[model samples]
Target: MPARRRQQGPRRLEEFAFINLIKRRFGRVPRRVAMGIGDDAAVVRGPSTRDWVVTTDLLAEDVHFSLDTTSFDDLGYKAAAANLSDIAAMGGSPTYLLIALAIPTTLSQSDLSRLYQGLHRACRPHHVALIGGDTSSSRAGLFLTITLIGEIARGRAVLRSGARPGDLLYVSGTLGESQAGLMLLGKALTRGIRRGLAPADRARLIGRHRRPTPRVALGEALASRRLATAMIDLSDGLSGDLAHLCEESRVGALLDRSALPLSPALRRFAALAGSSAESLALQGGEDYELLFTLSPRHEAAVQRLGRQLRVPVTNIGRMMPARFGMKERDRHGSLKDLAVTSYRHFT
Candidate 1:
């Protein structure tokens, strides 16, 4: 009888492995590109009708994720999602990506294949191409760097500084869901009991953490209709992103705690864990939803956009004079400083 084969096969150089995989995926050079992967630099044509948008993000092992908790596919997906979220926040459509992937000795050829597959899955729907990238061996765990390039019609890219004193603060979809998902995963990890959560609940929370959707469609719609006054993505939590937007616009904001949207899943998780959904919504990061401001006069228009796009648009607050500071209105209609800070590395 033949001996059982090891899960990981014989290894090869990083370049040899990745290049072969990329060539298999590409099959053909795209019409818009004068060059493909394996070049010193990628040369591709830009859309003449739109301005270029570029964003870079990094996902590191230990800092961003642990393989024990999530798969290589999920790491790839979240890394792409995070970069795509940046393009979406600008009211643009992602079109291209350049990756710098560092693989640790722990990863095998199959692992790399699965990781890139997840990245491709994230980009395929958005018509994004993987143009060029560099691969290197890593002494540490996995490190993924993705640079996404996108486009918005000339003069249509939303800036974080466009918000005004009277603009309404809005967020797409519910907050706290992703953070709750992270906490649940952490809980399961800590207790060493994966079955603590109901099967459905486990899937929901972990999926939210693993695969986040970029709001490109809604962002494009908002920009095309001239609806958003200012925009940002919820990478740094509501409190932190709100502070960033206000800082950019030189304005202040008043968030209504009652108006903040929370998902039923998050509510349930919070109840079970004795955690505060409000706190999660405010300070939890990695939501990847768009947060935008719009003029008060366009209230109806914003609602129409939301319905047309079939994405929830919650009006959580309004912009105010910068001197007024960032404040939140409690359910009792009392105002207090939104003193919470979002998560920061090494803080």
Candidate 2:
């Protein structure tokens, strides 16, 4: 019998790899491409009336998560959820996705299968089909890049730049839970395997960090009603994400500390960690919630949407003149500089 041929270094990178290689080869990047590598999907000008919204996101081991703390399935679900959140921010419905996975040779086939299963579990409900992708081996850690495609009706896409002064600010759900969950997991891990936690607590915290649900329905609702003047996903903490919306809109905002929502679990965890819950609420990332703005006239409509969606649409504050800059009120009623800080790639 012929001996099995030794495996080559890396199979000629296909699909996205080839596309990216071509782009690199060219000195110029396409301007018509509406979205590129850093988001959930890539948007491009199509022949149709609607503009395609595209974004891509990458989750890597150690940088984004660790295997000790996160399960393979949770990691897969989160990788896709992050991209889907970007689509929701653009006021679009997710249509298709391309997945690129780089795995270490040590990982078993069963582990890889669980990871893919997680991706399918997250995508199928949103009607996002996994159309194409590429796979490669990496010596370092696991890396997943998901490219999502969405569509917005002509002239109907909500951007971060459209908010004007007096526009009310709103968020879809409570904040800080994911951060709290992470803290709980870390504590449990540090205490070693013997200092066990209740199954329920472990499930709750782990689930929060692993399976964040993007507010796709709320985003579509906002688009359909044309109620949101500007919109974005609160992926990188409320403070950071809200700052993004304000910067894009060329306006500033003030969030009442009391008005910021926090889950009970997060509050309890914060107390246990000897940290301020407000700080986590401000800077904690990966909430996967929606932050939007609307005119006063649309307040009732937006509130009605909250009722329908069973999600709280809290009006935390209003947009101010761009020159005023962003600030948030402290419990002592003092105006403190609210700096925009979030997950920055390469920072």
**Candidate 2 residues 1-347, lDDT tens each?**
00111223544433234345323422243465555433444554464888778999888888888888778878878888988889888788887677777778777766766776777778777766554455677889988888888888877878999999999988888887786677666754355331344456556655777798888888888986799999999778888888889888999897788788887666666665667778888888888889999999999999999999898888888899998888888878898778667843211
Model 2, residue 329: displacement in angstroms? 1.6
- Candidate with top TM-score is 1
**Candidate 1 TM-score over all chains jointly:** 0.91
What is the alpha-carbon lDDT of model 2 when measured against the actual structure? 0.75
Model 1 Cα RMSD, Å?
A: 5.6
lDDT for each residue of candidate 1 in 1-347, tens digit (9 for 90 to 100): 00111112433344565777866764555689777675567788876778999999887888778887778788788888989999999999888888887668888788888888888878878878778787666778788889999989999999999999988999998888787777776644445334445668767866777788888899888887889989999988999999999999999999999898897777777767767889889988888999999998898998988898889999999999999999999999999999768764211
* Consecutive 10-residue window with the lowest summed lDDT within model 1: 1-10
Report per-prediction Cα RMSD to one decimal: 5.6, 8.1
Residue 27 local lDDT, model 2: 25
Model 2: lowest-lDDT 10 consecutive positions: 1-10
Taken over the whole model, the C-alpha lDDT of each candidate is 0.82, 0.75
How many clashing residue pairs appear in each of the predictions shown?
Answer: 0, 12
